[model samples]
Target chain A: MLYALMIYAEPGLDERIPQEEREGVTAEYQALLDDPRVVQAARLHPAEAATCVRVVDGRTLVSDGPFADTKEILGGLALFEADDLDEALEMAARIPAARMGGAVEVRPVVVQP
Target chain B: MLASLVGYLRDFDAAEEATQEAFTIAAERWETSGIPANPGAWLVTTARNRAIDRIRRDRTLTRKIPLLPEPEATMDEFDDPVIDTVIDHLGDTGIKDERLELIFTCCHPALPLEGQVALTLRALGGLSTADIARAFLVSEETMKRRLTRAKAKIKATGIPFAVPQADRLEQRLDAVLAVVYLIYNEGYRGRVDLGAEAIRLGQLLAVLMPEEPESRGLLALMLLHHARRRARFDGEDLVLLGDQDRTLWDLPQLEAGRAALEEAIARGGRGAYVVQAAIADLQTRDEIDWPQVAALYRRLVELTGSPVVELNRAAAVAETGDPAAALEVVDSLDLDGYLYYHSTRGELLRRLGRDDEAAAAYRRALDLATTTPERRFLTGRLEKL
Candidate 1:
């Protein structure tokens, strides 16, 4: 089964930190990506760069700064192919973001042919 | 019968249903032709035949449901001679090691504790979902869903159907033992059937895991406590330890309990269960050493770090003839609303001639006490005060 671990972290976390400290954190992410079980991983741009668009009736509406303002913003995501939820959670726990006052929400990916 | 079926058929739900079908056939056939010479073998053969038929049916359905895996392996595995050997051996001893695997899988740490308890009782204890629901005071539908979800999780996770390797055994053993003791303790509280089932499981665990001293220790602790079941009550009133009639205890069970405890101790290393069993064994004696009991409780507290153990240590301190010191120890601890703690405080206060404080403590204990005997005992103490 495949699980998508959605990483949520404090906004502006990447840019607010020192370059050396950020390198250490990036090293952990690199190690996670190197794991055999990880299918894909991507770090997102800061939430400040996010743009949300929606259609109301016939009109298209564009909004700035994520769909909703929140303390924790979507920072990254990893797609893991694991034997089970327990296996997936094991990988999720190893994500560096999980240890830095952030959280990883693991959801089963709906596989479609 | 079910274990052997599981050995042949990897799927638990299929194996369980096959065993059930085998029993139904036996029920009808035995009524007319009398009992078979080898009923176990008869059931195994019948269940195997049923499982094969089931696989054949599923194979045809696989065409309609493309998502369903082909059941050819189920039929192909039937050709293996190992299945027959396992059946023959299991028929002779009745206990199968596959059962140990099943139990461990049910109590796997990945699953929620509630799910573990529900699954263990259902799968190993042969309990109906309704029976387990009633035991836990939950709705039958809730228990059904719980069991279904747990079983589905096990299947999806592909949890291995084998005893854990030595490296993983110690960690896994703790969960298995906790589930077994949880069942036993629930049964110990007047659920005779559950208690007996727990003891049977404990005995099976001890026999299967002879190298693990904690298994033997658990069985020993349960047997010792169970031996005093008859003397634990007097016409719905809870009988305190001091008031229980020693003669009414089950002598044979006590002897077996002591022997099991001795075996655990003889194995050398002292685990929490072994220490608890040793303390229970000492309590069964005609004369107990209060200081020694206190020492054991202190060791238990160090090992478990449980507040309940500290409370028990206080009781042992009181038994050492210093109610004042015991009261001080009790005061230092925090076990609010625990009936026994309040009653213990009441007893110590009464001994010190502080009647008003003792009466207030007894009243609090009475309010918290749930069992009839406990309420009665507390009321009697309060009346005397």
Candidate 2:
């Protein structure tokens, strides 16, 4: 089955990490991406950089920030190929953001034939 | 039967439909042909055939066909064979392990705790969705949606229907045991028979995982508490354990609970459940061992770090003729919102000849109390003060 590990953390959290410990955190994430089960991985720009668009009465309403103002923003996402939800969760727990002041939401991807 | 069928079908909906169809057929056929010698085997064989036929008819279910065992065996071929052949092929030990698999899958940590409890009661306890809804005090539609969403997630997420591997077994089993205990506690507080349902689940778990002492310990704990259910109240008033009529207790069930606790001890079980079960057993004795009970509660507090256990330990300490120390322990705990904390503190204060303090504590307990019996008991204590 395919699962999406949606990583959520405070925006600019990477910038807050100590310079000495930053490389170790990056290495941990790199190790996770190296796993054969990880099909795709990407870290997003800060929520401040996001542009939100909404359709209001067929007129496009453009906004200057992420869709919702929240403490935690979408920090990263990983597409993983796992046998089951448990396997996907095992992969999610390895995400650096999950151990930090963040969370990972594991959702099953709908596979279209 | 549904458990084995689920193992065969690999789909909860399909297995449920197959089981229903099998029973409907049995109801009609049994009236004319008389009941079969082994009705369970007959139902299982019939359900498997129905499931196979249904899977064959539905094109979308073709993906699951590969997962089915003996896909080549046509429905006609299975008509007359001793139904036991299929059960034997499925590996029938004393108790089928498929139920354990079903339970583990239902109680999988990936699922929400509420879903796990409802699913465990539905799948393993053989409870109807309506009965589960009533027991949990939810609308039937809400419960139906809950079950539907849970089953859908299981299918979409590929939650496997098998016992957890050795590495994850302990944690997963604990989740399963916690769900059963939660059900038992809910039943204990309410008028519903969820307690019996929980005990039934505990018994099944104990049998399925004989090596896991916690399972037996949980069963023992529930049985011991359930044995005293009859004397727990006296006409809308809560009755303390010491004041309860002993004859009202279920003696045979209490004996069985003791036997289970001994088995757990023999297996070197020192987990939280085992320790709690040991404490419950000691409390039931005619000559109550207050010191031993306090010691067990201390161990429990270490194991769980729960203020409720500390409060219980304080209560036990007071019974050992040390009200002042027990009062100190109770005061240290941050349990102002807990009714039992206030009640226990009231009792300790009354014993120490602080009538005004005791009355205030009793009033606080009465304010926090939700049930009529609890409020009445607190009122009585205040009156005495």
TM-score of each: 0.60, 0.60
Instruction: Enumerate residue pairs that collide in model 1.
Output: B237-B373, B238-B373
How far off is residue B138 in model 1, in Å?
11
Model 1 earns a TM-score of 0.60
Candidate 1 lDDT score at position B239: 80
lDDT of each: 0.81, 0.84
Could you tell me the lDDT of residue B348 within candidate 2? Answer: 97
lDDT of 1 by residue, A1-113 (tens): 88899999997677888999999998988988999888888889998789999999989999888876878889889889887665676788888778888999887776643
lDDT tens digits by residue: candidate 1, B1-385: 8888898998899999999999999999999999999999999999999999989987777656756652332211212133234434533555655557767777887678888988877665656677678767688878877776676666555554566666667668878888888788767777767787788878988876788899999999999999998898887777877889999999999999999998998887498999899889888888988899999999999999988889899889989998899899888878875888899999999998999999999999999876677788899899998
Number of backbone collisions per candidate? 2, 0
Candidate with maximal TM-score: 1
Point out where model 2 deviates above 4 Å. A5-83, A87-106, B1-103, B112-156, B160-162, B190-192
